[model samples]
Target: MKRKEKFENRKTVRKTECRRSRNLGSCPAAEVSKLQKTVNSFAYTLEKAHFLDYVQYASNEKRIFRRAFLTGLLRGFGTAVGVTVLGAVIIYLFQALAKSNLPYIADFISDIIDIIEKTRK
Candidate 1:
């Protein structure tokens, strides 16, 4: 049998067994109590996790947009500063290499530095 069919058959069998065992004909109250307990547990979990606070925050469009804008602005500024520092470090390394005894590498780095200087003019 299909998986879903098997699951449904088992569920039906359990319901019948439960009714027989409890001697409850319709078992409406028992089902309602079970549902209520499940709902209460879910609500308690949500409350404990502060889900309502997050929902309230998300419901405010202006606050969400403002937070997003500030986050993006900080990220962009951080990226710019990081890149500048990294570039400076790389140039310093190149300068050190230019001062070293390796003639070919020194010449190549010097040429690159000259090109960069020319670009600023």
Candidate 2:
């Protein structure tokens, strides 16, 4: 058989199995109670998690903009501080190396340090 016919046969088999497994006409009250319990559980979960408040906050344009601006500002400030600290540590290491016994490497590191200091000045 073709792929479409095989898929339709499988679907029909699944439907037959489902119908045989559940006699819904004879269990209306049980079905309604089960459905009500599921709905209540879902609502209780949403309320506990404050899902509505998050939705409201997400829907407000001004709050979103303010949050984004603060996030960017903090990220930029953090990056600047981190780069400054890293540069200072690297320069300190270079200065230490400049005082070592390796003459050629010391000279190169000292040149770099001097250039950096000049740029700062």
lDDT of each: 0.88, 0.88
Q: Model 2 TM-score?
A: 0.68
Candidate 2, residues 1-121: lDDT per residue as tens digits? 9999999998778656645666655444655578779999999999999999999999999999999999999999999999999999999999999999586999999899999999999
Stretches of candidate 2 exceeding 4 Å from the true structure: 1-27
Q: Give each model's clash number.
A: 0, 0
Report how far residue 6 has shifted in candidate 2, in Å. Answer: 26
lDDT at position 61, candidate 2: 96
Model 2: weakest 10-residue lDDT segment is: 23-32
Best candidate, lDDT-wise? 1
* Per-residue lDDT over 1-121 for candidate 1, one digit per residue giving the tens place of the 0 to 100 score: 9999999998898787766775554566777599679999999999999999999999999999999999999999999999999988998999899989596999999998888789879
RMSD of 1: 7.2
- Cα-based lDDT at residue 3, candidate 1: 100
For all the candidates, what are their Cα RMSDs to the real structure?
7.2, 7.7
